[model samples]
Target chain A: MNPIPMEQSLMVAAMLFSLGLIGLLVRRNVIFMLISIEIMLNAAGLAFVVAGSHWQAADGQVMFLFIITMAAAEVAIGLALVLRLQSDLPTLDVDAMDQLKGGDDA
Target chain B: MFWLTSIVAIVATLLAISRLNATHALLYLIVSFLSVAVLFLQLGAPFVAAIEVIVYAGAIMVLFVFVIMLLNLGPHAVEGERQLLPPHAWIGPGLLAAVLLLELLMPLSNNQFIPTTGTAKHADHSTIPTIPTEAAPQLQERMVVGPKEVGIKLFSTYLLAVELAGFLLLAGLVGAFHIGREEPRTSAKPGAMEVPSQEGPA
Candidate 1:
């Protein structure tokens, strides 16, 4: 049997997820927002691993592998977009990319 | 041991998200990932723990650092980050996250919600014996789900998902290449003048 209870382990994942959510909501930098999204994905992976351990199943780890794969792909595209954005814009501030915010009217 | 690592992960993650410098935040995030890998180890998912360290702390973080360096963010950028994140900026999100955390924890704290321990479905599968430690006597005879079983499951049950993941990665690679490539200056813009000056030298 594992020493720590499953609930407590899940609580840790929850806290991490919440922190990531806060980061996502507060940070204006696109890179920081991407980092926050990574944190959230990691937290979700933690929860899956914990549940797998609870049931003594390998399915959780399989899911985690998928998560890691998805995160890798996402980071690749996101960083590429960031590079493109940096080349076009003077600043990395997300608010600066407001060309689509307003309608056709001035 | 588990609690210690969990605390470290949480604290490191908190510090990571609040940093003004991108590189500094990435470093803290690495530390946080390492701590979580330790947690994965304690949970008996050694395979996952190793991947966590190798991919998260090693590969992904290196990618982040490379991008930050390529961007060459100066002190002015750090100053801009500070302006973007004032002391007052944290209040609303912090409160919202706190409330979400409370909601997640309230049920977990209740005794009635604790899951009952039962025999594992794969109890017959081979498990590596763990050495008894003074700190965690209960983990002495715990079942360790090693990489062998995970590999079997991946190939047998999750083969389709693996193929899909590979396809997704390929698509991402092509997309990133197209998006990241420098565009030719064919448009009638100010930068179009510079294109001929570079070609004249050749």
Candidate 2:
């Protein structure tokens, strides 16, 4: 099998990244939003992996492993925050949690 | 092969994000992640692909699903979701994505975009023999990387980062425990507990 072009792999990563961005922007559900963030992170990791493969370096995989670790930590804290949000606010709607106000506000 | 898997991944992600049901979205997202794992495998990162499945699709999605189950969002919330996601929501992001795609493609389409030295380095693929031959040099000298090389690199050069990641994970664990823990209600009055707890000013 002929080797896949690096450009093609990068393009795929870009597409995934864009789709994830779209999801993050359009989704209102807290869970959906979190999932979108995961998609974005994975897309980044894919780019790194592809670059590593192109150059035949181990750095890309190592970077991806770190990305995975960071993502795992993020998901844990994010879910805990979600649980707290649901209990305290009684809703997961992002728009509903705008209680923060500046001093100028009456 | 890469194209096919990437198309599938993109389609799954698009379907996932467009769905109103959180569970449905999660399932589709899993599919997307799996397809990306295939792409990773094609790229020669077997270990990364494995983790993409085990850690990403398995562990992470399970966490999301658990939260979705825990929340038990009502039917009204679902109905509200449809209304909340207006047509205008697509405009901004869609435009941004288009611009990003154009930018990414421009460099790839133009051969002169890459420096001479960079192109020259990879211009010769004949030396990098994929198939083993009787007279071929030691396989260990080959550029092909596997989990073993990844581990070696991690422990040697990137060991500090690995240690830092461990610290980050520990902090996340502690934070989650601290934040998610139920606060003790000091007041004996049941009504006092009814008051909303202070958090993040929202």
Which is the leading candidate under DockQ? 2
* Cα deviation of A80, candidate 2, in Å: 0.6
Off by over 4 Å in 1: A100-106, B73-126, B129-140, B186-202
Q: What is the C-alpha interface RMSD of model 1?
A: 7.0
Write the residue-wise lDDT of candidate 2 on A1-106 in tens digits: 2457999999989988998899889878788888889989999999999999899897999999999999999999999888776766656777776654311123
Provide a comma-separated list of chain B TM-scores, one per candidate. Answer: 0.62, 0.60
Summarize candidate 1's per-residue lDDT along A79-101 as a digit string, tens digits.
98887666555567888777641
Cα deviation in Å at residue B77, candidate 2? 14
Q: In angstroms, how far off is B172's CA in candidate 1?
A: 1.1
* Candidate 2 DockQ, CA atoms: 0.39
> How do the residues B62-138 of candidate 2 rate in per-residue lDDT, one tens digit apiece?
99887776666454556655654557655434443444345434533543223211222343342233432532333
Shift in Å, residue A59, candidate 2: 0.7
Give the interface RMSD values of the models in order: 7.0, 5.7
Backbone clash tally for model 2?
A: 0
DockQ of the candidate models in sequence? 0.37, 0.39
lDDT over C-alpha atoms for residue A43 of model 2: 92
Docking class of 1: acceptable
TM-score for chain B in model 1: 0.62
